[model samples]
Target: MNEVAQAAAAPGLAVKRNWLAFGTGVGIEIGAADLRVSVVRLRPSGARLLGEKTIEGFRHRPAAQWGAEYNAFLRTLGAAHLAATVLLPRRELTVRTLPMAGVAEKDLASAIGFQLDSLHPYAEEDAVPAWARLKG
Candidate 1:
């Protein structure tokens, strides 16, 4: 059996991959009470299934806690893939689609910054954010 299957078979197992070599990517989303995160294996046609983990009790302030939790998730899951994209709440964006306008072209970081500012309810300027365009 491969490492992936072994890890998957074990309860509460985390899978790590060298994203640069494997072309894998990570996705994260901020939820109301908990943070939703996932790992995606990138492919020419689409992203393949790898693994996902969620961090509970995510608060707005004291951002360091989130980092620590993420590190813990990676360590517990044994995931070494460093490239990650965090998903922001769509409602945070001050965008209305009355006429079905297209999505914004700005970098994902900027958009997340805006979302964090509004969703956080507290001022935060130290977190770094990055995102990639995912094909459907």
Candidate 2:
């Protein structure tokens, strides 16, 4: 598959991905109590940020709206498609160590989810979980 499709599928496949380009699309960032929207243009080295404005007059905006707006923005940038990456706040993600044996790919998420369910009683779905194996 191409880069954009690969990036989008990576998350669902339990792999990590990043948005390398805006591709004629905009990005919207939504927080629990805050909302942000921006359009961006990509360069070979970095990105040119545009539409750095806050959308007002909305009491409760769904996260999906932000995503759609971002995609539309990318289209305006002359990009045939766009890459979407959901950036979770650092505070929302709890990174910690865990002991893991020879684990299979299918079981890894469940294993971590099980462990985190205890530590994160509030909302495990709201957070992202990752792990690593330390050298002996």
Candidate 3:
């Protein structure tokens, strides 16, 4: 069995990986109530979770304090060298899904941009929009 399998079998053990060899990535999501960080190793087969951490008490904290704590947590995971992606709070995002029968994949982003004013709650200039086709 691989290290991932062993970690799965042992509930309390943290998943370990040589992230440098795997070119891993870290994803951080700052939600209203908690902050979550997940380290993933991308492979030909699929992405595997190397580790993850969630910290509560984010709702009322100062921004500087939260940044310090988040940095410390990443250091603990040895994730400072990894590429990171941060997801802002969902409340700040405007998300919508529309079905267009003949929209080509190449024109999707442009099409979304053209319709942003009607699809999003905020003004087109104020809102940032992202779209992906849903698989049926």
Candidate 4:
């Protein structure tokens, strides 16, 4: 990841063109009581697991402290460019699939977006809804 940084600072995964050659990324999961991280590199030959880390009682620890440890691990593995993708606990996420048989491609965004509030429990201000159009 960028700085042995906590995934909270860089919550989403961003791909770089150069990554097509390296295929390196870090996966971070925020669990109920701890945080887990994994760094992997994919090559034509196969995928290699470079490193893994877990921090217990993550909710109670200071961000800076655990974040430093996070950075240190990636620094040791020389994973400076890997984007950290953080996965929140299942309880924090809401999944809803809408059947839009007639929604035009251009209207897909607005169609799903308008229903975001009803899809999630969070208040209007707190909700950060994201969607994708799935194909069968």
Q: How many backbone clashes does candidate 2 have?
A: 9
Number of the top candidate by lDDT?
A: 4
Tens-place lDDT per residue, model 1, 16-47, is 33233346666788888788877666654557
Q: Write the per-residue lDDT of candidate 2 for residues 44-114, one digit (tens) a residue.
A: 45567755645443337675785466456555655426454555556666667777688676897788768
| Candidate 1, residue 31: how far the Cα is off, in Å | 1.7
Which portions of model 1 show Cα errors greater than 4 Å?
1-22, 43-47, 76-81, 95-136
Worst 10 contiguous positions by lDDT, candidate 1: 92-101
Q: Which candidate, 2 or 3, would have the higher TM-score against the true structure?
A: 2
Using lDDT as the measure, name the better of candidate 1 and candidate 3: 3
> Which residue pairs in candidate 3 have backbone atoms (N, alpha carbon, C) closer than 3 angstroms, thus clashing?
none
Per-residue lDDT tens digits for candidate 3, residues 20-51, read 24567889898878989888877655678878
lDDT of 4 by residue, 1-136 (tens): 5575654355443333234545888999998898899999886566899999997887899999988888889999998667799998788888888999999999989989887767877888877878777878
lDDT of 1: 0.62
Best by TM-score: 4
Indicate whether candidate 2 or candidate 4 has the larger lDDT: 4
Give the distance in Å from residue 105's predicted Cα in candidate 3 to where it truly belongs.
25
Q: Model 4: which ten-residue window has the lowest total lDDT? A: 11-20
In every candidate, how many clashes are there?
2, 9, 0, 1
Candidate 2 lDDT at 87 equals: 56
